[model samples]
Target chain A: MNKLRETLREAIVEAGVKDGMTISFHHHLRNGDYVLNMVLEEIAALGIHDLTVNASSIFDVHEPIIEHLKNKVVTGLEVNYMGGKVGRAITEGIMEKPVIFRSHGGRAGDMENGSSKVDVAFIAAPCADDMGNLSGKYGPSACGSMGYAFSDAMYADKVVAVTDHLEAYPLADVSIPEGYVDMVVCVDKIGEASRIVSGTTRITKDPVGLRIAYLAAQVVKHSGYLKDGFSFQTGAGGASLAVAKYVEEMMEKEHIQGSFCMGGITGYLVSMMKKGLFKTILDVQCFDMEAIESIRDNANHQEISATRYASPQAKSCAVDSLDVVILGATQVDLDFNVNVHTDSQGYIMGGSGGHCDTAAGSKLSIVVAPLIRARLPLIVDEVLCKSTPGETVDVIVTQRGIAVNPKRTELKELLVKAGLPVKEIKELKEIAEAITGVPQQVKPEGRVVAKVLYRDGVEIDTIKSVK
Target chain B: MKIVKNAVAGTLESSDIFIRVEPSEQLEIDIESVVKDQYYKAIYQAVDEVLKEFQVANGKFSINDRGALDCVIRARMETAVKRGGEC
Candidate 1:
């Protein structure tokens, strides 16, 4: 029987959305997503209030959520990451309850274990059939992997697939099976194509960023983990991409064939896989058009569910096998604790998407950032909000120097032996302070605005109001 | 140095400050910054030091900062004061 519906309103009504129920959405569409706002508008029109939104991530384009939050249509937020627009409002104490933050892996684990429940899940399906089979690989608003939406479809009490492209029944390529999705609705569009995926990803041209990338690449080479069949993960940032470039060169020169490259797959990694540097690409989500194209075409580029990608509850996820993962940070303390949740001014502008999960699971976790950003030093007395505990972090690479975690003494010795600039975390902080002067601490005197949960479901830190 | 005309220096970009100077009845420095919550005192002191060095007492100094360092702020304020003074 056909499960297709006429509109999202009909689907929402059929799902029985009620006040205080948790509704879910995924961020595969990134800054271009329209489903969340659309669904919320319908729910608000239906007079739903005090609902908790469990989105995989929130982007600037979801700014309409700010008005919804103000109107009490949505009083609670639980997310893996948040862009600055809603983050700024939340940091200003716009909601009575502090937003609950979880890592990508943690979000999936919580959902699977029934700790964090979702009443209804609205999947922004790029392409789907009347029978409810869906794939994010084809169609106009295609965003590559539908990794983050799997838990929502599987664990939620009701799952509605909102699609712009309605294909025939019994679709061949199904990322989300029909058994989970109860309803499917065709819409004009799921998201803006341009905003969903960047046309291309670029490497850094900045000398400071390039220097940091160089040092980080050197550390990877000497860490004794850059051997054949090693697995790796990196972000889409300029420096992180540049590090991949360097590492690719080294791997090619040394003829070291890697097993797989995982995380938010970028075009750079796709090229590396094509060049025979890696055997496969374990993509959780795609970051650019090239990556989307590769995943749609190349058999070696495989899409993986968030549970298989990093869920701690999994028998053993891909992250546990990850050899190296490079991440970015807003602040890193002398204790090596990393803060990606808030900025130097103690405002909530970011969160731990997979920062903690990767860091905790990978054999070596490297945080690369400039020593100074807009005059604020990177290293500090303590991070304002500890997003990822320093123990999981193995290295901190800055343009000036690289600090190997004291717990990683053998790795430090290896890096030093390679003639890389390895210094104590304290020394690196001192070097930064000497150049930028000691910045005054931004006091967190206001009430709590957000709670950061580690990958293991523990409350790691609490973000305070900006006032 | 004597207050002559309205002048501006620096940029609004991150790691830079935009400074505007105009003749006023008294020394008035207005500071707006992205980092004002944490670095307002340092920014104010740097601007004051620049004004003292130029020895210009009566000007409306408007500083809009995007987290510029002390040295960059001082340099921008100095250039702004000089531009507002006699050639």
Candidate 2:
């Protein structure tokens, strides 16, 4: 009988700790994540620096990571970080180097292509059996889906499952299989599921949000694309979900039978699927209890891998099949280039995870947002950084009006001629500048903090978060 | 004037819901006034019954719906009436 060491420190030494090695972590825990900190503190204690960290996503809880960067214990950074403490700090020019940001699909594609090779992947499995079979479901800290970790387990050179609860043998229905794992370490707690799933994906309460939703739906309805056999996807935000709601009403009124609704499945979508509004739901991950329950019960709620969701080379990616993809933007520029990456000051708050992919693949990409938020203009002369290229953004819809990309002159003409509430993107930009007086410039020290890579595996622009 | 009556006390009152009593004479309703959500009609139904319970009559009442689905809407409106007041 073979025996394996159980301590994280022991596991680290046994896994072959070196000066320079690639380490990966998953960000399913969101803002309240703690796995990254626990593991990094130990890694830093070992004086092992100059390492590449592949996180599925980074959250505000990862603020301690800044210490790692400052101490030279960590060098390269990678993950999808939304606007929060860590993201803002990094964007504020805290990190000395630019980060490598990838969309959810992009990260998965990287693993498949051997580009993002991980030396060791530390998975914080919420629940695990003695032999290393694990799951994020059925545990106190269930985050619903193991979609993000699925890639790390497949591609990483060594897989370690750090978990709080270790079940007895006969671990059936595995979330992370025993085959891919090399060792297991037990901890007091993996995370709080309440916190992981705590962030409410509710629609906006603001009247302006309702207005934008109404206008965005009107744009779709007027574009004459509100027809049968169409397909769509939207993020799980107030504006995005509202777009879906408004669009749903239009489709029902027009008797339009959509082919499918894809990506991050939510209860709102499950209800629509239940209503037979769409024929299928190609779900990559579930966002709420209803979505998880729907996956458990409904045959149509198909579980999809990242590669199948948006690989440029896939035989048929779900994103490619999208007739329209409603995306959220932090800000947009006159060139129509949109930035979901950095903040107004060009900090790496988030990246293109599937944003660019979907925008590029979808037939019509609409960026639905308010013209001004907290009195800050959302439309600027030049985007702080380019995450989703303007070429793919067909329509920019706000509560005030809608602007079609000039490159998409056909769409511009169609929307304009159809009497859709239309305006030039410049008009929105000017209004914002007029209100905010061209917005004070964000000065970021000229050292790349993250690389914004295009789909062809080429570097487009390097982001320097403001210092 | 229509009046809404019979409502659940404290528990349901504090939530994002309401009840109403319409005496009659009201067109369908304004979509703009309705809050965007998965089930906005819930707010509408709740308000309708509260008015019926009170036997209040002859005025228009508007509802600002959030996410209260049909069932939730009906529940909230009727519940809001115990501490009755006019909208």
The candidates score, on chain A by TM-score, as follows 0.99, 0.91
In model 1, the clashing pairs are none
Error of 2 at A427 (Å): 2.5
Q: List lDDT for all candidates, in order.
A: 0.93, 0.72
- DockQ score of the complex predicted as candidate 2: 0.01
True contacts recovered per prediction: 0.81, 0.00
Worst 10 residues of 2 chain A by lDDT: A434-443
TM-score of chain B of each: 0.94, 0.38
lDDT per residue, candidate 2, A134-185, as tens digits?
Answer: 7765566666567778788888898888887777864765767788888888
lDDT of 1 by residue, A1-467 (tens): 76888988989998999988999999999999999999999999999899999999999999999999999999999999999888898998899999999999999999999999999999999999998999999999999999999999999999999999998877888899999999999999989999999868899999999999999999999999999998999999989999999999999999999999999999999999999999999999999989999999999999999999999988999999999999999999999999998889887888999999999999999999999998888998989999999999999999888999899889998898889988888898889888767778886789999999998788998999977
